[model samples]
Target: MAPPRNSAVKSARPVLAPLSIGNATPSNGGTPFRKPILTKAQRKAAPASGGIRRYQKSTELLIPKESFKRVVTSTVSDASKAHPMRIGKEALESLQEAAENRLVKTFEAAQLLAIHAKRQEIQQEDMKMIRRYQKSTELLIPAAPFERVVRELAQDLMSDILFTKDALKAIHVEAEDVLVKIFEKAQAFAIHAKRVTITDKDIQLAVKEILQ
Candidate 1:
């Protein structure tokens, strides 16, 4: 006798192994994002509701078995190789000896020392600039004169102190002075266009105009 086939009785679908995209390093909270592909069988056996059941289980570590190991190894090896170059014991000792013996600086040594010295000088100049502006503000004068003096001093100090690019500092000071003067007279500021670039001659003219 032949067995009766029923509409309700269905054969179990074959589960296919998953595939991985690319290998990447692991982190404290792994946030690997990938676009997954449905197996041929999985596509055909679509859920009645059509929602992906696999995604509901976990959002992390979804790579294929083979690439998972490779990713871990690659991350570790890369980190070790890229670690900072250490001055080894012998090299450190030699450098110390050279420093003690040589009165003249080598090119590399001179460059390093010069940069460090410049940074220190720049810091000191900034402090002095602040004090100079304080003095200008404290001087007994009308608000207009006080502001003009402060602006000029600040611009000159920015150049000497290296707080800003030297060329722009003068322009900044001059713009500030113009704005302050206009506000004092008109009770409102002129709509500022881009700053008019003052040259050495312009700076000389401004000082002569204000001081005289």
Candidate 2:
């Protein structure tokens, strides 16, 4: 007839009340537990000093996607006798990647040319030389006075950096060697493409292959 021992032990244990937000009060008589709200000025200033701010490299496309797509569409239409062609998103992206890569290759070639002449800044002649060199196997040489142009451009591009005359000459020699290698690879690419004319695309492909 007596109650079980377990029941007696349970009844003896102390009970705690559930916490209620409305009933709770701050220790310092301030507002009860609530998130701090920022003013407009405070929000604006937060990024200046707050550790919460984050920075990342830009992800914007170098080539305008819409414009490139339009150009591609136009080219395809003209080539296919005005037939409608819908390029998939993946294909467009791939084409854009290739075009961007080609542009980078062209710039790199020009830069190499400039450096080969001991110039830090790329000139119009440098670009022209790269184009000419890519198109043919002929010995392509810049007509500019190499030493003067190199000194001027080097000073312009590296105003703060110091380069000894000997160092500049060494860089020029190294750059020329690299340029010859690039030209040879580009020629090979043109041959592989089965084209007598070495186009910019061939140069780009060659650069890609060489890099790989």
Best by TM-score: 2
Report RMSD for candidate 2. Answer: 17.9
Q: Could you give the C-alpha RMSD of every candidate to the true structure, in order shown?
A: 25.5, 17.9
Compared with the true structure, model 1 gives a TM-score of 0.15
Clashing pairs in 1: none
Q: Which residue ranges in model 1 land beyond 4 Å of their true spot? A: 1-51, 57-60, 82-212
Across 1-212, the per-residue lDDT of candidate 2 in tens digits comes to 99667877887888764434676655445446677899997776464533322312444457889999999998988888847778899999999989887887898677657656877678999888767867874333442455567778878988776667687666667666767677778866764665545788877876787678
TM-score of every model versus the real structure:
0.15, 0.35
Question: Clashes per prediction?
Answer: 0, 0
What's the lDDT for all of these models? 0.46, 0.71
lDDT of 1 by residue, 51-93 (tens): 4345435543334534544554566567778673444456545
**Error of model 1, residue 87, in angstroms:** 26
Alpha carbon deviation, residue 19, candidate 1 (Å): 44
